[model samples]
Target: MSAIEALYIFDEHNATILEHVYRGRPPTASVLLPLYLSHPSPQPSLIYLPNTHPPTLVYSIIQDRLLFLSPSSAESEPLLALEFLHRVADALEDFLGSPLLASKIESSYDVVAQLLSEMCDGGLVSNTEPNALRDVVEAPNWVKGLLGGVGLPSSSPSLNPSSQTPFSLPRPSLPRAPSAATANPVPWRRANVRHTSNELYVDIVETLSITLAPSGRPLSALAFGTVAFTAKVSGVPDLILQLNAPGGILNTISLPVFHPCVRLGRWKEKPGELSFVPPDGRFVLAGYEADLLGDDHLASFTSTSSTSKSLASLNLPATPAVSVSLGPTGADFEVRLSISPRFQNKPSASTASSSSRGGLGSRSASAFSATGTTAHPHIEEVKVHIPLPAAVRTIADLRTSRGDAQYAPGDTGIEWRVAAKDVAALLASHHGGSVSASATLRGSVVGEEEEDEETAPSVSLEAGSRWEYDEDEGGGYQTSSSVEPAQQRNGNGKGEAEAEQRSKRRVALNRVLMPSSATVSFSVKGWLASGIKVDALMVDAKRSKGLGAGVTPYKGVKYLTVSRKGVEARC
Candidate 1:
């Protein structure tokens, strides 16, 4: 039997806030708290306490600064106990609002007790869905108080002071039909749901992680994607969403995870097709990972030997190429950034343009506008980070051809920011031009000066060697023969050799100050690096209930790609 013996909640100060027992005699909060705390910080979720009377397995999770712990003496499934704790936390947040504070739980003990009892039956998992729980539980009186203060009618009945009935006398009750909690078929959806506005939104966001070699060859490129869905309708509606990707999603996406409401059978039969009854509010519908450099794409890179062509096949909006050059003086270095030509050209809503938009393929912008979709894709927050060696004391004479560059004396790196407006200006200057736009940043390296040991005074050791002080010259003591050689060396070729040695040392020191890699970060909307796009989102009226006839819901889809220091080029 999967049973949770007891649950204990602790506040940020490790003070016990609430405790409840579900089934069987188990260790109390006092006994379990110290044993659990004995472990080192960043403790694991599950721990075994052999010192207890019956020996218990404790499962714990921390959320919103509150610690939830469950201890079980009986042999049970570890995941069940862990998941139930999470469900309890979520249910409380749904009922009491977010940032589940200790005071909130202390004031709403009645509601919390009911929630715990209903969620677990004799220590076995029962009804944990918030939507279903709302039907069985009554709203706290504080909510009614707030409504009454606002001059709105309260749902609960109020008592009359002039009544003749006795205080203990029971009031007559009327017969009623089965409540929605028992009558509703779905466990996750509440009964009789209604909304004034009918709308559905699908937002797809992908983050890119790419590394390129100094020779402009892609080492690794990956895209992590998430789909967030928000549904606000007047009834329980069924939705079928179709997703399309270039070269088919079956071969492109890997390690995909979907929400519980989604129909897995449909997804397994036809990849990229999602069938589900959505939750009422915003929630993550799915997540996936796609590789930008597949075997076939890498093969193309080998044949053409062009990094831009390979990246273009991935539909990248802006490709950054960083090259570092050492100046002849060896005390200065230059960093150059070349943006892709595609960024300068305006993206069209044509099929050809969509196919080449950044990933494998995506729907055109015109299609979205025709369906009342807003938020066209654009690029913003373009920044480049160049890391310097620790030995460099400072970066002097810092200059940039575009935007701004900042560096601190002891900082290990330099940040270069190019605003979106500046990027637009640069692109406009190169209007209708095939050449890619470029920006350059130059800086001088100032390293800590090393003390020359050769310049120190030297003494010659011999059997009768003596040191003498020069009174007239006011110079320190020195060997009599050593002064003659020192004067001769300065007048001959030795001085030139020493100057050459010092120049070589400066060059080596400057080499240490040069950056080894540069990373680029930016966000692009209306495009995806994986070329995934929504084809359609249709409601199934036959299976839906309470939806009015001729009601057309507003549907919108947005695509966004982000890179947070994920694109790196090694020098």
Candidate 2:
């Protein structure tokens, strides 16, 4: 803030006070403190500081760091006794980097100080006037301890705290988060599946099994429960399937068709025999044909590897999670399976570095993870946006109107940041692969009427995600089954629902984008159904899990999706 507009002695507490004129414009988040005390005494404050270029003030204690600011500045007006005391706290915080985030903040402060001192040859405040804020200063015993003997405090000999604890990883506490944003990095494990190629490649050694939601059924007027198949034994199954989508891979849901045969089973994974094999060392399903589905075939692959490792070795979700994945290999290829209907964590997940102003509350955070036979042969990414309901939004607005919730230059909506690598790694670790990519920049502030194009910038991994994949893709649609798979079969693509409630669960949509390879169907515990039909899709190798062909990535692009309400399709 520029300077206090006015200061006065408190008529009630006989203390000094300061008032600040912060934000006065719409589309801006502002903070107003009309009772800032200048006297070092505990009495109430009567000073004000108003509108200036998004002012930043570092709050510090006698010899300790306390808080930070975006554009920290020096005092432009006479320091009220209270204000002077606060300056100590602010300076200490500036020097020490209060509340301690990563060590980088202290370094940042040092850099900024060096520049200021070198450029302007300005004087750094040393001594302080008395009676300001009083013992409100950090305890002498905690001076050095507060900073764990690093940065500002460590450099200053006299100011260091006497009673300090040894340096160690501090337990996470709620107070450390920046006041302007939400902070909490959700814990997620890499989704280790059969497909390791986030690029492009398919398998033929294993029969391809396909499933859709709605299961030729219907959702209640209130929307049907999204059913998901969990896991399956990867081998030659009685039947194999592939999606025949033509609305362009980007527009897979626009078209829909019925699979020749496939039924649903709950936890019941029993088939007559090992139905098919990967003839070309590729992943395949029995009785399915490739040429009939058109050369639109994006990728073609075959598998020839054996499963010496089992799913039990990994400490992940439920066992056999679904109920598919049981088949005999023709040559050897990792099987690709997914859940039907799809199950998602309602709150989704959030990262530690997100804006806090307009974000959803803590109650709206969640995490989802799964593991399987292989680590990386394929990769998938899902994005779900849950906007605030009108009721909550209204309440938040009312609070803001009363000068509570914040937004704008300094303030913003609470944010949830998920690094691109996080999703990439989840796909990697499971397939026994590695994730590589170009770093991404943080999102920027927006205008209210901003179009999606301007608001959504393109993003991707610098290098492709890598895995030790030995699987291939399938061609055409279903090749093995003519009598259809089964009804209510156990979960394979879909894992077991929470033991408590297996019915009518409200969840988010799980969108799966294959690595540039359209042919490699990576096995997923819950991403699709068992009976989903497809009319036509322009499959490409770009989304493949292997470094095959046509491995493409798009920012904000609708890459892989399946909708069953009207038509069943996948991109």
Candidate number with greatest lDDT: 1
What is the model-wide C-alpha lDDT for candidate 1?
A: 0.76
- Residue-by-residue lDDT tens digits, candidate 1, 1-571: 7888889999999999999998888887877889999999988999988988788899999999999999988788999999899999998987787889999999999889988988998888898877667656655776657645754333222111224466566655422334545476776766666777788888898999998778767788999999998888777899899998887988778999998889999999988899998877677899999998875755665485676666556655455554443666477777776665455424444322433221223333564432111123566757989899887788889999888999999998999998877777776776455456778888987776532334555443543447888888788876644346657666467668867886787677667667888888888766788888888888899988888998877786778789998888887
lDDT for each of the candidates? 0.76, 0.24
Model 1 residue 138 CA deviation in Å: 5.2
TM-scores of the models, in the given order?
A: 0.73, 0.16
Tell me the lDDT of model 1 at 210. Answer: 91
Residue 16 displacement in candidate 2 (angstroms): 9.9
RMSD of every prediction: 6.9, 32.6
Name the Cα RMSD for model 1: 6.9
lDDT of 2 at 196: 26
What count of clashes does model 1 give? 3
